[model samples]
Target: MPMLYLNTRHTLPMIGLRVQHNTVDTPITQPRYEQETQQARAGRGFTQPKITIDSYPSRHSYGYTNNTDFARENLERGMSEVQKGTSKHTQMAWALAEDGPKAGRQVGIEFAKRDMEQRVTRQRTLVAAAIPDPVIQVDPGQTHGAPIPAKTTPIWHTEGKAQITYHRGSFETYLQQKGDIHSWTSEGKYDIYA
Candidate 1:
């Protein structure tokens, strides 16, 4: 099971400038670990194994900004304020769509509604399916960076069909493989905000 811990903070001026915090613990039926076991058994495991990579690229063009000079100035200033780092937008979009196709469609619709160019072009984010058996070995000592089994040619197979159903305030993801089910609750402020 996957454990989620959340803490909410609010100011309490009535009690001599004190702070109040509420903690919520929600246990979730963990995502399947079949991939982890397969990677280990296949000897493709590494000190750091990247199981999933989710990304959301916001391709919306900001609406008109007064005039060209004003836009140019803002662009320069914005570029200066930006720093090189892993962005949270990617994970956020994935989280919104991870619930399933209905939720995923909502994500694209929301993004499309925001961009004025929706008629000409639509900006959307997609969540990638679980990776196949191709695992990367990061240990320098392991096989000198060559993929295990040495593929002669590329082979492809479906990752299986996935469907999510919502009941009450919880959702269950059903996989085609042996009808495996993963459940999650839609509780807490994070759920509301998302």
Candidate 2:
């Protein structure tokens, strides 16, 4: 079971926008024995008859036979532009962390005393666990992408360990499977990636 093959070689030339392709292997279509519709299974299927191929791939090579709006303005002059996101230094780091209004009210009262010491250590470990029944019944259209119904809700959690999140549509499906939206790229993944 020795399988460690990498060979990861991608050193240049991928100049895309190809617009022309080919791959065919067609040759097959024959069943005109007088358009035989089972004449008693072609007279009891004679044993000297077997010709089957029926493979097709000839789409007369794609479309566009000149309805040229200057060939779509030369395919939009090598079409590309579609990148976004620009929070201007994340709104100047939250306006320089709220431009010191009394040191942002002492860092919001030390984050409300560390969120009241994590809600008094989660109400003292839920005082021996047995209060969860609050969901009496919430059929918001058969409950799906939930969490919004709330009279008062801060049930902030995470003693850690609980994953499966991946945001931003799994980062644009991993940047459309390893990005290259027809080239012209720039990264510095926002907030200047720490």
Candidate 3:
């Protein structure tokens, strides 16, 4: 039996392979508006009706799977040359040619999976720092007669965002604002009542 002794220390340097990375993002949730209403007193008030505003915070999330086909192909191609007696390490290439591709592919997959996870975590941190909390503004305007039960609906316009970063790149962010008033009736002295 002829034993093959493969030395990777020199073969790898000669290959000079470059790593490639790609990212794809998909929105898991659709954008929509929701409202919740509550009743509160205008508070022993003078004239105008007052409103208390509450807003929901923006949210972010991500998911991914690692496919190392690219890494597998590159590694196999590079190692095959050695297996074909093209390199000094051909003697050792026999064993590696059998198991090297599988091991290399698994390593590549694990590395890519971990890398993607870290990227997602970092992106989430960046998004949290970038997006500001939602703001709700209400102008009670004027009221009349007596203080009536006011119906106030806190409105929130929420949407999912998918940010894809290629080779550790940056993403764009912006603020969204929404406002609305529903079902108000006026009788006498009190200015506004819901």
Q: lDDT (0-100) at residue 80 of candidate 2?
A: 32
**Which run of 10 residues does model 3 get worst, by summed lDDT?**
6-15
Over the stretch 1-194, how does candidate 2's per-residue lDDT look in tens digits?
44333222233434334233343434344333322232222222223334443222122123223455446855765453221113434544574588646542555456557658876887443234332222233323222242333233234333343334332321111121332223222343222222
- Model 1 spans > 4 angstroms off: 1-88, 95-97, 117-194
TM-score of each: 0.15, 0.13, 0.17
What's the ranking of the predictions by TM-score, best on top? 3, 1, 2
Q: Model 1, range 130-156, lDDT digits (tens) per residue?
A: 434433344333232434452343344
Compared with the true structure, all predictions reach lDDT values of 0.44, 0.38, 0.50
Model 3 stretches with alpha carbons more than 4 Å out: 1-13, 25-147, 160-194
Counting only residues 3 or more apart in sequence or on different chains, how many pairs clash (N, Cα, C under 3 Å) in candidate 1?
0
By the lDDT metric, which is better: model 1 or model 3? 3
Highest TM-score model number: 3
Candidate 3 lDDT tens digits, 1-194: 44443322211212233444455555356556666766766655345556655433333212221246456766898799666545434534653566557744554445457658876888443443454454667676663556557686766666645655445445444333333334333344333322
For model 2, what is the alpha-carbon lDDT of residue 61?
Answer: 21
lDDT minimum window of 10 residues, candidate 2: 167-176
Which candidate model has the greater TM-score, 1 or 3? 3
